[model samples]
Target: MRILIVHNLLWAHYKSSVFQALQHLVDQQADLSVQVLQIARNERSRAGLETSGGETPPTYTYNYELLFDRYLEETSVRERTRLLLQRARAYRPDVINLTGYYDPAQLLLLIWAKINGIKVVMQNESTAADQQRGGWKERFKRWIFSQCDGFFCFGSQAAKYVIQLGVPPAKVLLRKNAVDNNALRAVYERALPTRIQQQQALGLKPNNFVFVGRLIEAKNLPMLLTSFAEATKRSKNGDTWGIILLGEGDEQTKLIQTIHTLGLTEHVILLPGRPWFRVPEILALSNVLVLPSRSEPWGLVVNEAMACGLPVIVSERCGCAVDLVHHGQNGFVFDPDQATQLTQQLMQFMDSAVDMEQMGKAAKQFIAPYAPEVVAQEMLNGFIKITN
Candidate 1:
């Protein structure tokens, strides 16, 4: 069996880990092979994450080709379609896994693969709650999904969204996402002893709830700030706890102003974004991970924090929330729009009633099955199912 995965970005360190696992799995199997087609070096929005200038390079164990050694935004649809089709024809894959349904170039490639009797497995990351569904767009998505042989969704919400779009439940082959679990755990373990020193050096509180992602409006940063302040007022030991907002985006200025207005300048700390690999360093100092995005397809940072044995507080809208978070156990999931609910959850963590260490252990256990190696095996099983 020959499999070709069409992925969008080379700068995706997490996806690289999964591909590495897939390549390892294929190596042990007879007559099985896997290759990847990376569309571009990175996207314009993710240029800061590129490890081109002396940073440690990511591990690339899979056989692959880079379609364009530049940002994807610079590539035109016609050129992408031409090159993608040209490459697919040359690779002669038995099965192809496309990244998503919205890309015109990939959709054309999907049509060509179906016409040639090659199996098509689509990877879906979008959920029904993440965005507004509509007239022609949903119809177009249904038509595209109908042409797929199988689907590898990011989580239960994503799978449900596809089934709602007219795809049979049996066609949903895999329902998980992954990150470099082993690597993240190793980093966190190594940094554990130095956690106090590092937090002191950065002038951070002893206990903190860390939010890792772009500081955009969709992240509901303003609401998070308000909830944090309210939680502080409700807690008896609020002086020992703080909230860290890590990552940079267009909403930084507004968030800073809101912090000052809420009289949370001392309690709310804003840190610039770091590459995904270095995120565990920040996680070492945090007691809990918080992602309050009003609309998140799949919050991968939640996975990273869980791998580091930190409980998460995720929004109910996140695709990963349903599968990963067990409310009152590993973490709590609350409506992003409800300030009171988030505040109460935060206050619970700030108080001594909840055992965060026990919850963190539960989080690590919950995220174990979503590791790269496990997810890679599940993906391979999906391929075998459709191919046989």
Candidate 2:
């Protein structure tokens, strides 16, 4: 089997699942050749083009920015179409996989593939309701869906959304984002050693709640800060509970200001965003993980936290909350936008450290089956069913 993956970039620190999936396919060694073609807005500098290993799969690049921003008015839609057609002819891919937000390139390639009797599959996170906002973009997306042989969605909600867009239910597949359980097991095994070093370095105590992910409106950081502040105030053991906010984004300055206004300087600690490799170290240092997002299609970090044997408090809106969390059994799920609910959930974990630990252990067991390799195999099975 030969597969071509079309995405926004070849490598991104946050998109580890994609890398794991592609790597799993290559590791199958079933006479499979996987090529990754990235359509990016920025050109990679000399320093940015280094490969991790010699046998990495996937190769192709089409700079959308070069066609739009660099050339100004020179490149036309017809020229863009011609370029993509040329690439399709050269690669002659058995199957083309599309990822990320919709792009003109995806539409063009899918249309061309349909005409050439080639298989095309689109994987995206957008819900059906999101496409109902009447506009040229919605119409364009509908047209794109018409050209694809199958659709891969992040969860059942997204699969339902895609089916609502006129694709047959049989053609829509649900594949959740997964954690690298092998890596997670290694991290958990070394947790004690890493935690000792992390505590020594950061001056963090044994009991602290950690929040990871981008600081943004969609993440509902303001509500989280407020809820944590309230939880600390209402706690019987004052100063016993500590909150660590990790990752950086557009909401950082505003969230910092809000933290100060609420007099939560001592209770909340802000850490700069670290690379993916260092996340396990951070997760190991904390007792509980919280993801308060207003609208999370799926919270991959929650799975990672659970895999590392930490209790998680995720928003009800998160897709992973539906499958991963069994309230009071593994972890808790609260209304992300509601300060009181969020505060109550956090207090539940903080009030009893022993119960939290037991739940954390349960969390690890809950998500053990949905490992990256297992998820990748499911994805391959889905692709084969759709193509056949």
Top of the candidates by TM-score: 1
lDDT tens digits by residue: candidate 1, 1-388: 9999999998898899999999999999889999899999899887886652476955767888999999999999998899999999998999999999878999999999999999999999999999999899999999999999999999999999999999999999999999998898888899889999999998999999999999899999898889989888889989899889989999999999999999997788998887887788899999999999999999999999999999999999999999999999999999998999999999999996789989999999999999999999999999999999
- Model 2, span 106-170: residue lDDT tens: 67788777787778888867654322356786677677787787877776667766676677887
How many clashes does each candidate structure show, in the order listed? 0, 2
User: After TM-score superposition, what is the CA distance of residue 113 in candidate 1 from its true location, in Å?
Assistant: 1.0
lDDT of 2: 0.70
Q: Could you say which candidate leads in lDDT?
A: 1
Pairs clashing within candidate 1: none
Candidate 1 stretches with Cα past 4 Å from truth are: none
Question: Worst lDDT window (10 residues) for model 1?
Answer: 49-58
Residue 202's lDDT within candidate 1 is 89
Runs in model 2 deviating more than 4 A are 13-32, 40-84, 128-136, 194-197
